[model samples]
Target: MTDPLAGRVLRGDRRAVARAITRVENGDDSTDLLNGIGKSLGRAFILGLTGPPGTGKSTLVDRIIAQYRGRKMKVGVIAVDPTSPITGGALLGDRVRMAQHTLDSGVFIRSMASRGWSGGLSGAVSEAIQILDAAGMEVVMIETVGIGQSDIEIMKIAHAVMVVTMPGLGDDVQVSKAGLMEIGDIYAVNKSDLPGADAMVVNLLSMVRDMKGRSPPVLKVSALKGEGVDRLFDAVEAIRGRFLSPAGEEMRLRSVRGMIVELAKKKLLSEFEGRAFARSVEVARKVADHKMSYEEAAERLVDG
Candidate 1:
């Protein structure tokens, strides 16, 4: 019945938070820690940032931390970096660009390795955000691995998904083909000072307009030069408010239901991967050899 993480994290202890995150990333079942932080939840706003590899998401997140800190708000950043092939550590880990805040006690930043996990986030991302949330961080930013199309999982964790893209990326086609144009609650065209930046914003607007009945704001920003970032922050608040507002209770309910489903799916996946999953690979190879149809292979897996 001794829960050490609960007290250390609630006391704003960085070491305890880091340990807890590592445990979660490795898929440890923190049933005790979960119950510890349950009452401490709902105070922090979770913001998710996801996009293609070269979208400058880390820089944008660094700027956002500064803005939030300026308002005297405590900020927590979970930057998901690609896992290194050999070492299996985070590739661009620790966010060197955001090094300025390393000394600031009000800002807590941690880089996580994707570890071959998809959906833009590592397995323990939501749990890490929960730790930060429980620690009294007012705003928690989850920056995905930024692997373009696989980043759809951000929608599951964020109250608002900021799909970050920049100019000269030929984003109009890439965004549409990647199926990311529909998942974002807010769109930010970064590097707006560059040429074709305005055009990119227009392209995003056109795509959003096609969604019909949903009016998510698309903005132009220069995360490098700090242009239009305040508006982006304001838009995040507005979008969250719109979801929690009187007229949008349905959306809130939907989000709750979605989270429940996500949790259930995670549990089931963990169970499947735990024992005799090698049988799945054996069956898959048989299917690949044309000895069985995919449907038959799936049924065999189910039977197993």
Candidate 2:
């Protein structure tokens, strides 16, 4: 049953792909489905695009899809957008930017809401990538929301992590806040037509030089005009060639394991609350009345 759906998706059935993604995202009795799908994964190259907002990430993603299409490669994109906490749906503005490729048979795009999951993405992204991989995409791109700091989660999932930036907007401060330089496998300066572009490049290069052997390659591009995109693709290909070894594959698996453990821990802790632990108001009242110190209250709850 899962094999047929997986085969349909690989044969360019968009509905099958969409249904698979929905199942993975909802995670509603889908483990068996995904276990079957996982056998077909591990073939696709997963690329993670992360950076601050207004850095032209969506535009760059569009250009990447175009370049891949030129090579006759199938591409799948998962665009993670901020969600309305109350409604739990995506604003989906990023998807609107990439609408030009909606009719393209080789490209599949899905918009996901962050849904308050922190880490600049919802936890379902790993499953989404697996679904796309099982669908036989040559490349699966994960575009994360531009939330600073949390965006580093991309490093755990992608074969290559592209940190996009642009001129102005206190690039230094942003890099520091996000700690992106440490996590990025490649640095992209988009919107290179803007002023201060040269200076930004210079600063990034200087920083890269200071970091010495650990720093990734930096490339400048103008996604709107489709400039330097080919070089970016080449860089991606090169990174894959150099790093996609057995050891590198093990590292990625370890990361996935860590994320799963962390998520399961959170879920288990939530299940233990109230029945095994005091409610928030009860703890607050205890603290307010000086019946227990905050640390003592927490220790008691955990001990209970």
Candidate 3:
């Protein structure tokens, strides 16, 4: 059966695209949608923005959207916000900064909760990207939740990852501590109007100078005042071809391999939660009563 929604998505029907993404988020069976949109996957350029909190990533994204729209291209944004542990919900407020684009059909913005999934991204992000790509979005941007040192999973998925940072955040020392300087393809010092912004840019450039074969650009921008955004946009747009080259093909292959491994892990985790949680209770009781060792209990859980 041909899924009608698939056709609508191909035609860039916003409602249908939104519905498809919702289905993906809910963990529904989306085989038909995936098959229908399979060939349309690589059309959009996927850009990821990640950094610590209070770096003005949301504001920068809003500016980027305007730049893309000025060129008459369709854009999609996936903003991942931290999940609320108490209610298992997200405030989903990244869109508030992007309110200007809310009514523009040329732009599609969706906020996803991290859902306690680590690495600063939810599991549904890749599928959601496909949905927007199939809907004729020429550029799709992923803004990850405020991240720390080990939350570098965006590198595996995005063609280019831009690390956003600003002044007043302890600058180079904090960046080195977080290990963010190495993962970025582009670096933007947002809020460059601030007092310490110039020093931050200089230090970042120095840090990235010995970055092996890559000399990633460290640009300064004030996303709030919209200063230097055009140069930043140009810097980001220029790197799109690097991922589409022969070497990029190799990179894409690795990305696919990683995706497959992640899928298998997720599947195993789902099954484990379903059957193993109940069995673990019995095992725990046995261990507590001194009838079994922790190592033995672990082996039994996996073997069973």
Candidate 4:
């Protein structure tokens, strides 16, 4: 069959952009499209925003997009929401906050369902980002499904990962449990106007100080009222500048290499499971039941 999504991706068509993202999210021929979209994708900066559920990640992303748009930047957003296991549906409520941008030609927003992926992202997210990059987006932001801890997968693909948190969410135990200290390249204390905001910053700073190596800059902002957003933007630009340099590029390349290796390992294991290994498993099961010694079974399989 002809690849309609690939055609649209290469042509930079917006509707085609949406369609390609849908195909990726649904795991429909995404590998072919991604292969075509690679190398062309390095042009866009991939920003990953992740955090606890109430941290205002979607609002902060919306504000950042608006700021980028003001500077004539083309923005692509991938908002990942959890899928209902029973219904396989996602609310996609983040898109509603960005409705104003719908009228702006420069902004493209696509929502993805996590489909029960354990790492707080949909399987299609990486390919979707490539499609946006190929479509000429200068910046692509991925908003992960906010599932407290175990959201570290975004760190693998994002050039910079932002961990967002709010005031009074929990104790120091909560912060540690969330895995916030290790994953964030930038820490955003969103909703700074709320009570206990300073305490939150202090706790984060204390944690960073203790960590002592490559600690991300922590900034406080109120996404709802736009307080401290300019500072947040400045910090983001500075972080981007530092990380996109030669050294930063090296780190990015290393990350990409690691991802490829992991993908290969996964694919190889899958292939082995479906082929020669299937018969091996049955033989191994018999060996386990004492039908034959393990060594004898292994020798037989190897000889066969």
After TM-score superposition, the amount by which residue 204's alpha carbon in candidate 1 deviates from its true location, in angstroms, is 1.3
Error of 1 at 37 (Å): 1.5
* lDDT string, candidate 3, 201-284, tens digits: 888898899777879899999987889999999888887666666667865666556545555565577678778878899999
Q: Write the per-residue lDDT of candidate 4 for residues 142-215, one digit (tens) a residue.
A: 87744643346655677778888889888466656767677777889998988988899999988878885776
> Which model scores highest in lDDT?
3
| TM-score to true structure, per model | 0.82, 0.80, 0.85, 0.81
Better of 1 and 2 by lDDT: 1
- Of candidate 2, the 10-residue stretch with the lowest lDDT total is 84-93
lDDT for 194 in candidate 1 is 87
lDDT of each: 0.74, 0.72, 0.77, 0.72
lDDT of 2 by residue, 39-77 (tens): 665777778898887687877887788788888988998
Q: Give me the candidate number with maximum TM-score.
A: 3
Clashing pairs in 2: none
Error of 3 at 141 (Å): 0.4
**Clash pairs (backbone) in predicted model 4:** none
Give, for candidate 4, the lowest lDDT window spanning 10 residues: 83-92
Q: List the candidate 1 regions with Cα displacement exceeding 4 Å.
A: 83-103, 118-123, 145-150, 240-256, 278-297
* Candidate 3 segments exceeding 4 Å error: 1-3, 83-103, 118-121, 146-151, 245-247, 278-282
> Which run of 10 residues does model 3 get worst, by summed lDDT?
83-92
Candidate with better TM-score, 2 vs 3: 3
Report the Cα RMSD per candidate: 4.4, 4.6, 4.0, 4.6
Residue 276 alpha-carbon offset, candidate 3, angstroms: 2.1
